[model samples]
Target chain A: MNKIFETPLYPYRRAPEQDEERIMRHKVVVVGAGPIGLAAAIDLARNDIPVLVIDDNDKVSFGSRAICFAKRPLEILDRLGAGDAMVEKGVEWELGRVFFGEREVYRFNLLPEAGHKRPAFINLQQYYFEEFLVRRLRELEAEGRPVEIRGRNKLAAIGAHEDHVTLEIDTPEGPYNLETEWLIAADGAGSPTRRMMGLDFVGKVFEDNFLIADVIMQADFPTERWFWFDPPFNRGQSALLHKQPDNVWRIDFQLGWDIDREHELKPENIDRRLRAMLGEDIRYELEWSSIYTFQCRRMETFRKGRVIFAGDSAHQVSPFGARGANSGLQDTDNLVWKLRLVIEGNAPESLLDSYDFERILAADENILNSTRSTDFITPKSEISRILRDAVLDLSAEHEFARPLVNSGRLSVPAVYDGSPLNTADALDGPAISRPGAPCPDAPLGEGFLLERLGDRFILLTIDADAPDEIEEDGITVTRLALSVRDDTTGALKRRYLGDEPSAVYLIRPDQHVAARRPSWNENLFRAAIRRATGKE
Target chain B: MTDLILTPNLDNADDFYATLLAAHEGLTKKESDALHARLILILANHIGDNKLLEQAIEAARKAG
Candidate 1:
């Protein structure tokens, strides 16, 4: 028996004039029940904000889409209370193997950073990730802050006003109207919401198609990422194998400049190709497969009028380094905290643009880095092949060269610069503060580290000498023991900020080191908080 | 320049290890530093012990 979440989708669409019987307007309407949308809804609803999420799909599909979840997304999920379930079901890849043809050029373990407390990366099916988020949404509904998930409710049109957004939704019952205080357009790469507003999605699209298939195999392959450049199965095609949760393994083959896409996707043709790639001796069962074209595009502006873009709706990138979904989710983390402020009436409309400016920068950085990685892996020219081969050959002998073989630099955290939210004081001078970047995770006693400094202003004071006072109304000050100095001081210097004499760093909830100064001067700290939260 | 012709063969673990080490020799100083961040996790995967993993990370950081 299938369990469907029952909600009054039809009755909730009563006309505005029928005041007595009309349904309450949602504070936020999130279109698309994908992982990012569901995550956005869960985060907001958990904070006691009313949210309504609509999707065209009726039920979750059992297929692989986004397979990689980096360390940062795990932390975001951990805060929303969905980390435990995901950790239980997801496959963790501690090691990766880079191959130069059949020869393994590099093999290294993804040791979790020494001071931090989480695995480097985990692999789970995209749909399962969405399902887990929906389940969390359901739990939030049980509490006072309810999230209404309207499945099969397609969005027909959107009318964004100065204060609210009017949505015309088409469901099985009929056409219904929904008025929301805020409209989140997470409808994906080809977004209708983005189209309605006439926003430009601009970037270069790569002329390449990747064939991906999930197969169950009886083989003694170790738990590691296996990548092959120019494998024997297909000429000018790269082969990739990633182990999914359970016994299923995802294999991706890059089709060359010209090939029959229609013919290659047929089950018998795909099976024959898989057998040819694996060899006649290998026994495997094909589960599913699909073809995807790579695109490196981002919106000219993430926000236009009252509508805002999230996830792939805002940016799209090649999957070589697995930055597409991970970066989109990071955008969600940045935008949600700001929206919370706006809906609660703490910030003005100008604060909303920070979400666009900061995330667009992040999107650009992530896509460019990922695209460079893809180019390096699948080089087209003879010169590029020689350069790539030379690096791989040398990486086999030197510890220094080994790191470049797999190109793990693509996974580094993004720093938000050039935004009104980022003050010059955040980056300047010799200060003991979390400035301009995520404050490196510090260890507290009893295995409980301060992972989240909260979504608003978090003031960390190391000096207990000045009577430990940071009584700003909205800012939270957590006093740490002398031991935090060991990690915080080292991290600050590494980030080029040098030592902190005053012994305090105020960190913004987006995890950027906002101000690295001593015991917060009441007026200065309050002003900075006002600026950061857009209260100014 | 003639490119190295090495086929992708998982059965030859010795070849795999040797090839990886050779690739490590090619990185510039700054590039090597960035790459070291991800190497600890890969090394830990090979060893299969969390404590050893921590030790490897600490040792790598200390040596660097």
Candidate 2:
């Protein structure tokens, strides 16, 4: 058998006991060096904030987990300076085909429109993602940024206080204590931190089990998502196939709840199933396989005092929609900027409340969608199965029925429609780029719109004169004007200005639209800035 | 949207009608009615537009 990909392990270094006794405290301590934890650490370090990341494991990840990367997370990774490498190493796909029985019922293109910087989704092993993020962290550290990652270290206890949080960590050398002004718990689904805090998840636990297998083979399958409902090979069950890099194929089999896991994972049983799915002519090696039953649950509150929860530690969803890791990355994206400002004493601590509000909304949306998809895929009752089949049958001939066929509605960035940070739409040109939406990427002068908007407040003026620089209260405004020279194909005008002649947009550091107006006034812009920063 | 047309929409309408009648040939009246009810639900789910399905329901009731 060909050798499977494995993450390189780092040795655990002993820490001096005096280091823990030092009066100096770290700005942020992130528990778990998974993708979400590493991403959080990098985001903070990029903002010139030092962060310490601890994990119980020394390697990146055990197997090919969390294989789907949505465009929104890619854009967030781009901000962290690791987006291009991920995209280049992953398989880019935008089309998906849904099959019922023996026939193809529906096909959808995620990105039918153009002028976007990244594709709709990419498929890469989770280990590769963590490895790339660790590399980027090392690069940032070489450039004088503080990002310390300590492997083989586990959090034993957590104490949250009014001013800071104290942590007891068990390392290879010995156990020690550390202090941090803020704590981010990205410790994944079985989060020990959450358990130590005596908090329980509140939501639904699905009964259906799924077997995910990563097979290394040279197959001639297209790089599009293929979903099967009651496929012939897997009778009365659903299956999914996705192509990952390194010639690895991820296949998911919907195994009903009543099966012996050990028996199902036996080599002979797995080989028989694989032979049934792939013809005898195709030879392959199984790289990894695991069984999982997911739950759609979240903590009651993501933020409690000085400790905050991001990723699976705060929320979890079924893997149907690939919402698990993507939503977690967005949490880090929304959090690190607010945490940075709060740590620097530029913004009040109340700004962190918005993180909970916004991410809770996103988590709810993901759970809702994931639950619906699961229900459709595995109907609990006979009546629902009939209805699901009816919808699938009609989707082949009718346009209206296509939307009803839910084969895992792929992950899309959550739009913060009712966020308190948004300045109400007193003036609006296009509803697509309205308040609380992620700023749409467009072509600028020899670059992208997102590339120009740095980690600071931006006043983007379209078809109007750019304003002079304004810096106040630790907030500096960088202005850019969109002209014919900047947008040659008029993608920017079409996206930002539907029909209006001129418009001014206030964008937060995280690239979400804070407010927009047809005309620019210093007072209105400043007021929106203040509201976004939690000063209002 | 309220109008219903019983035209030759299928390529082999006569053959389909024959098959439809033959499908109920061996069934009792109660069984036939149950099959018709199931067929109605299946088609209604396919034509997912609630407004159009409601219009069709009203038309079927009026015809009955």
Candidate 3:
């Protein structure tokens, strides 16, 4: 096993603020150095906004937790300069096969045929994911960007205020006080910041435990997601197996509610289960193991005054759909840009309300999907179990029953269909590329469309008349003029231009569509920019 | 918008009930419940339309 988590990647050191009597206020303080916190800090720092990320632990996450990273989050990470390394190190797989007993129920393809840049999903250990993010943060620091990570620095207490928040941080040296214009609570599901703030997650709690066993082994198994329901190895209990990088495989065995938690984690018990599945002749070494129960919950709102919650701190879903870290990255992607604008006074403070409006929608989507998956995997009632088993059995024989089998739908980026920032549809575009939806990627001659969009508010005109740039109020909407010829595969036409001969799209910094029209009209585009920036 | 077939599509209800009882013969309670679930799922899928299925479910409930 890789010793990536044994040593502290970011060790704690005494800072000048600890000695100085003057309390220094930072631009942003992200409480937790996990994926969400690091992404938020890196994005802010790259935008020239000073950000500090503090975590209780100094090492990478110990186990191979959260192995699946979806396409959209990968794209967001790519924008943060962390995607290439992760894609290179991560195992790319898309096929998920469901099994009932010894017979295969059905198989599903998670990705489309072509035209997209990223894969359906990549399986990398959470430690490696965090390590790559930390590496990206280091590069930003090397570039003299104002980003700092203080490990072993725990938030002892939080004082929320009308304008800003006061943070009492406990380091190995001692306790120090700092103020921040904005507080981003990226702590994990068991968030201390949330507890201090008296915020609670309100949702369903599943009454089942899953023993996650990550093992390093040499096997000729194809790289595919294998989920078994009522398998011979673990009859009546569901089991899930995923192939990760470095010959490591993640296997989860469902342990029913009310089991001896410590006894179930015994290596002998884990080995027996593994032997039953992989056979006694199988050679493997246990890497890591943990038991977790499913809880699909989220806070009422992500923002509370100057304290804005992100990732697990705000909402948490069962890990079945790989929505945990993936959604966390999107949270930072959606948050950092808006925060940067507000910090620079480019947008009103009220624009932050849109963050709550948008992320709450995404969180609800994640929670709903996760709860459904959990209910399917672990049937709550006898009738439900009978129906579920019927679906599984019928799925193996009939094509009609396949759709009813839910081994957890693959994670997809949430389209903010009802975002307040979105303008009413003016130009007829592909439904997938509608306003408030993430822009579908299409090859543009040599590079991808999202790479061109980057992190900017752009007026993307396709065979439409538009100026080089338009300055509405204080925000400048740069134009990226394109022709149908640039779409070699015609995916742009199918995705962006539906049946309309020409189209103009106002793309947000996060590459979500803000507004669109058939052709660029300055008056309408100006109003669009105003509405998009929450200026109206 | 096809409604549920509540007016008896089969000519003899006695034969249909006897056949259903015969299918449940020698089966345990759990097995009978499983068979019933499978039959219902099959019929529901064949019915296809959710509105029509909702009507059928409501009619079956009212018959109780």
Q: Which stretches of candidate 1 lie over 4 Å from their true place?
A: A1-24, A205-207, A397-400, A406-410, A425-434, A464-502, B1-64
Candidate 2 residues lying further than 4 Å off, grouped into runs, are A1-9, A17-24, A106-111, A205-207, B1-64
Q: Pick the candidate with the highest lDDT.
A: 3
Superposed Cα deviation of residue A164, candidate 3 (Å): 1.4
Model 2, residue A331: C-alpha shift (Å): 0.3
How do the candidates rank by lDDT, highest first? 3, 2, 1
Clash counts for the predictions, in order? 40, 0, 0
lDDT score, candidate 3, position A133: 88
Best by DockQ: 3
lDDT of 3 at A323: 93
Question: Number of the top candidate by TM-score?
Answer: 3
Task: Give lDDT tens digits, candidate 1, residues A1-536.
Answer: 11222232223333332343464567888998877888899988887788888887655544678888877787778777787788888998777777666677778776676655556668887866777887788888877676778777788988878888888887766777778888888888888888877786787655568888988888866778877766667665678888987678899888865778899899988887888777778878777788877688898888876788998888888887778778877888888878887777667778888888888888888777877777777676765665566666666665655655544344555776556675556334443233456555544443434454655556665532432435444444544334335544254343323444544556676667655554546666667667676666
Q: How much lDDT does each candidate structure score?
A: 0.70, 0.84, 0.89
Model 1 gets an lDDT of 0.70
Question: How close to the true structure is residue A375 of candidate 3, measured as C-alpha lDDT?
Answer: 86
DockQ computed for model 2 against the true two-chain complex using alpha carbons:
0.12
Q: Report the CAPRI category for model 2.
A: incorrect
